[model samples]
Target: MSEQMIEIQTKLYLYDLANLAKEHGFKADDNWEFSMANNAERISIQKNYFPTNVTKIVPEILLQVLNSVRTALKQSLAVKDAPDAQSIIADELNYLVAFNPKRPRT
Candidate 1:
């Protein structure tokens, strides 16, 4: 179920499709019906296939995650400020510095 065989079959079908289309005096564009059909069928065949109940514990720091996202949304809505990654880091740094006990206000 690791998709090694599926990947090979996919390659075979690709070549088959190409050859068939060529025989009909037309080549397939990526945006062509054949392409779209293949793409659509792939979603049905392969998309939902996953392994069994391998219970992997994902440690989510939920409070931190939620607070970060909430703050980002608040800033975006209040000031139309879409937070970039660097700006978010800077904001976190600024927060730490402002609240730090060691840093005396001069």
Candidate 2:
């Protein structure tokens, strides 16, 4: 897929995740940023989250996100001598965590 297409799709997917996270009480401090160079893509979210936050999200949505990440990771690795594999996966992992919910107001 073209880089532009990937960027658009990734953004949309993240948006959906953010909305779902909110519904489940995940808190985010900022937005996601996308950067690419030499076929290496980096996606970063402003805050960090926890694994429990992920469990709080709907299982179906988590499954969908997992699939999308797997596909994107696979596509990136398909390139000959891919250098950004670690970076890509790391960013995806961070994105997942960024949805960790904040403690409820007392």
Candidate 3:
């Protein structure tokens, strides 16, 4: 995919995730950052507030967020618009889920 497409997809994914997080009772900050290294892009989702102690976000919420984004992406792709970029975003979301900090180790 082109750099422009990738950036657009990333923004879409972040927007979806942020909305999902807010719907799940989490505070999603508007301040998000992105960086590229080793030919890969990384996004940092910011939280409005931080807990003093270690907090483990439940995996269920993460799964819900992932599903929500996946569904939206599928719907967007159904219109035959930016299929490649949407697919990449979906794959990236899956990767996030697989390595989610909230998920239990198997």
Best by lDDT: 2
Q: Write the per-residue lDDT of candidate 1 for residues 1-106, one digit (tens) a residue.
A: 2344434433444454345445544423321111011224334322332110111111122123323333432322232443444554433321110011222234
Which ranges of candidate 1 are over 4 A from the true structure?
27-31, 34-106
Clashing pairs in 3: none
lDDT of 1 at 71: 46
lDDT tens per residue, model 3, 1-106: 3545444544556665566555545433333221111112222221222211111222223333333445544432133332243444454432232112332233
- The 10 consecutive residues of candidate 3 with the worst lDDT sum are 33-42
* All candidates: TM-score: 0.27, 0.28, 0.30
Model 3 off-target regions past 4 Å? Answer: 27-106
RMSD of 1: 23.9
Q: How many backbone clashes does candidate 3 have?
A: 0
Model 2, position 68, has a per-residue lDDT of: 54
- Mind giving the per-residue lDDT tens digits that candidate 2 earns over 4-101? 55455456665665675566654445332222221111112222332222212222233234345446534332334323446544334222332333
**In terms of lDDT, which candidate is stronger, 2 or 3?**
2
Q: How does each model score on lDDT?
A: 0.28, 0.37, 0.33
TM-score comparison, 1 vs 2, better candidate: 2
